[model samples]
Target: MSTHALGSAKLVLAQNVVHIDPAPAVFEAMKEGWARQQSARFLRAASITPRLRLIERFGEFTGQYPWQWTPAEGEAFIAHLRGGAKPIQMSTARTYEVTIGLFIEYLMDSRYGWTEVCGERFGEGPQAVFHEGNSVLHTIEYEGDPRRRPLDYDEVQALFDAADARPAKIRGQGRKGVLAALRDAAVLKTIYAYGTRRTESSRVDLVDFRRNRKAPRFGNYGSLMVRFGKASKGAPAKRRTVLTVPEMDWVVGVLQEWLSEIRPHFAPGRHPALWVTERVGRLSPRSINEAFVNARQAAGLDEDLDLHCLRHSYITHLTEFGYPARFVQEQVGHSHASTTAIYMGVSNEYRNKLLEASMKARLGEDWE
Candidate 1:
């Protein structure tokens, strides 16, 4: 029978509804139907595969199919996840709820006719197991781990110094990874210099660097064309060009050294990538992450500090350097100024300096 024929099965509305026994073929057809509907919406296979698996796992958990699931089953599954030996985080739980909720919504859609199909076949229909009361509410702007705050100025210096010393340390040990070490240092510096995400840093092309007319002193590296900005749900990747401010002009020298002296060592023939791996291909985000991990460990910095801390440091340092909120927001490609604000972890010293400046201005006396 055609896929649509399953949904058009006859329905019984008697006081005691008789349920049709769901065959294996019938269950497989429903799964295929959901997959087809998701594919029609143009979702990537990478996104669709995990969601399909999530629904299947949920079905297994309740010992029932989608049409037989109830809100109580969902609540029990969530409780099990939270009370297990390896409890999932709130964000993770929220994502699970959202994914399952979307699947249920797709089934309940009249265009798919899964609800009618289920009613006729099993005398029931799928209900949205996740609701406002049961789901996690997104009440905070920043819900990331508290340990993942921006690095302080001293810590930033220590990290950069550690990165710079890596090649020398390798050479001293009679190792031959100096070029790779240099590449790592350059990548780490570029990440902080532009406040770029890890994927954005990995995706940089040599030609993505543009000369800024306003900052001619920076030469051809005055602005970065970020082609892989964070994308919204079901949307194309966002793009933004971050201009080189005077404070981060040190990056210009680093880029020049890498292009003219170091990157050629990798023998990157005709490749457009700014960061090339030892294999002469474009660097991956995983490699970028490893670079930061090595440097952070070498610096003896906080164990909790990760690669993203550099981006946070950039946003905080730029704010501390007296740049306007909107300028920093645009540079970091944050859709909202509030997002930029959330990334900032200004030091107590900086806060006191602002307070002192305010007091001096009001009292007409120098506070320093």
Candidate 2:
């Protein structure tokens, strides 16, 4: 028997395996055993804790223990989730399937002895109900809202202008939020400049900025250290160094002004966070989102466009500016080139230009 089936002394699979008699108690033990297995594999609490909740919820829905779960129950549960006043996103539904699938995996692995244990106690064991036949397929590259796209160059300019205008209006009204207004503007711009997610933007620290030797003109603002890039399954936060490009050189001034002139006003002594609240704490992702929403509204941009569009805009603009797909992928901390491609919503002008260039190079001629 594999050690995975025979969980550690601290885990119920080993200690209280036989003692647990009631179905409810055994179900709890299964969760505890699974958590132990996840931790043993170096998974974080954030990953393991959620799985427990998901398992418990699934058990509640099926009105059965892990040993009693079947493919039918899992399918029914997912079907029920597929329809509602506010249905789950495709990504979300897929995540539910993956989670349940993994939980079932844990219980059926013969090495874990759960199959044997369940067969002896409950006369059955869990099986993966979310197999390819019943699960959501990963067909589309982008499963997000169709309306969400990269802001055009003009829209980006308008967004920054709107954000910049807020501080002036606040000062004119004798309001106290001028500093915060400036901060929010800077936050929004930085998110665009660095291709940062809201969480990545909020998690940035002052010390994270690095001077790229290749680009001395930008100084310490040349590269940004993203310590909280999105994590893959059962992984820690991904980290990457995003180097500044000439196309986004304008951001250097913005960062300098915020660091030297504006952020100091917050008096964030000993607080390392690049973006701080008035309380000297790191700003939350929600605050970063609100900053984008206010800027979007002020710019009179499309309602479907959200904070993520800024990141999309960054990826798209970089591609248009002739940056290599690999470079863009690295800058944005994406694991795969395909994932980066999903963000590239190139303009029609860019396509026409590319076609003209291709004709010139290949045919050595141009059409009228």
Cα lDDT tens digits, model 2, 1-368, are: 34433343234744444563566766777788888888878888988888788888888898887777777998888878878887778888898889888888887776667777677777776777888787889998789878889999999999999999999998999989888899999998888998999999999998999999999999889899999999987678999999999988989999999999988989999999999988889999999999888888999999899999999999999999999899999999988899899888999999999999988888787554
RMSD values, in order shown: 4.5, 2.6
Regions of model 1 farther than 4 Å from truth: 1-28, 366-368
Each model's lDDT comes to: 0.85, 0.86
- TM-scores of all predicted structures: 0.90, 0.91
Residues 91-183, model 1: lDDT tens digits: 778899998898788778776666877787679998989999888899876777788999988998899899999999999999898999999
Considering summed lDDT, which 10 consecutive residues are worst modelled in model 1?
6-15
Highest lDDT against the true fold, candidate:
2
